[model samples]
Target: MDTDTIDGQPRVVATDAALAFIDEIRKDYPDILFHQSGGCCDGSSPMCYPADDYIVGDRDVKLGEIGGVPVYISASQFEVWRHTQLIIDVVPGRGGMFSLDNGRERRFLTRSRMFDGGEACAIPLVKRG
Candidate 1:
């Protein structure tokens, strides 16, 4: 898939490995989706899901096909991910795999170092008082 950019943020593109992984995971869970939100750093990170929950403040994007599996982006953080691609690869000591920026080598992962599944995974990351 080609890369995309909107406003000043990067878009999410699926990598070869990511596509393959998505395919394997989709066999049982076809309703796959992606989501993002503000992180400790400059912006938010991409996440994978099996379904949608209509969460407010979240943006969702359709990533088309990566390894013959369908992908979706969050409706809340669509702006921040305007031009970034989600690269799939194994991270050092990170287990299975993780997502990274296509243009840069930056990787995004949950505090638990595991896939969060969906919106429920994003709640804890939200900055609290």
Candidate 2:
């Protein structure tokens, strides 16, 4: 899918792996959703949610359909990290199992690591059973 930016924040590319992961999770929990409060260059980490809980930061980033699933970013984060690209991959971890790549060359384990201002912590979502 072509990269799209909303209100400046870079949108994450939903790859086959990402879609598959979403599908797997959805099968167990139909209300699963993905949310990000940060972005690349100076943003937070990306985390999954059972429903949209986190408030939108700045721009409204739209991640193209992944396995027919939709992903979104809060409007607030979009304003600061616009045009940023996120790379998603599965990694072995305790609570936070997803990894984020801020279009930049650097990759981070948690969203807090990308943004220097916010409290650095791992945002973990419950694995769907």
Candidate 3:
């Protein structure tokens, strides 16, 4: 499910704060992954989990890597956001209780900006594998 290209502008990227936060958390939990959860109590945010802990099913699509952490979205959610570049950022809040960043007063978020025609054509669409 890794659809990365050397010259391609990634479909996803992480902010500096998000990267630092991930680094700090990774100290205790080395292998981590993120799943884009649908809108619910978590508000359509990305949920972090230990690698291979949250099973990646057939309906999930791999977006790209952010801070060396792989990110994915449910098929349904991807359909709605496929045209944009996903930006993972951190902001002050109580995150999903089960997510590693929950108690840190900062949570992983999914921010996005629609891609222009050229960028859209350049980004790769990753299907479930």
Candidate number with greatest TM-score: 3
The lDDT, on a scale of 0 to 1, for candidate 3 is: 0.82
Candidate 1 TM-score over all chains jointly? 0.41
Report the poorest 10 consecutive residues by lDDT, candidate 1. 119-128
RMSD of 1: 12.5
**Cα TM-score of candidate 3:** 0.86
Could you tell me which residue pairs clash in candidate 3? none
Tens-digit lDDT track of model 2 for 1-129: 223533333345555555666666667657655566454533354566555444434444565444554456664554444334556554344323342222223332322113222211222222222
For each candidate, what is the lDDT? Answer: 0.41, 0.45, 0.82
User: What are the per-residue Cα lDDT tens digits for candidate 1 across 53-91?
Assistant: 334233345544445434455534433433334454323
The order by descending lDDT is 3, 2, 1
lDDT of 2: 0.45
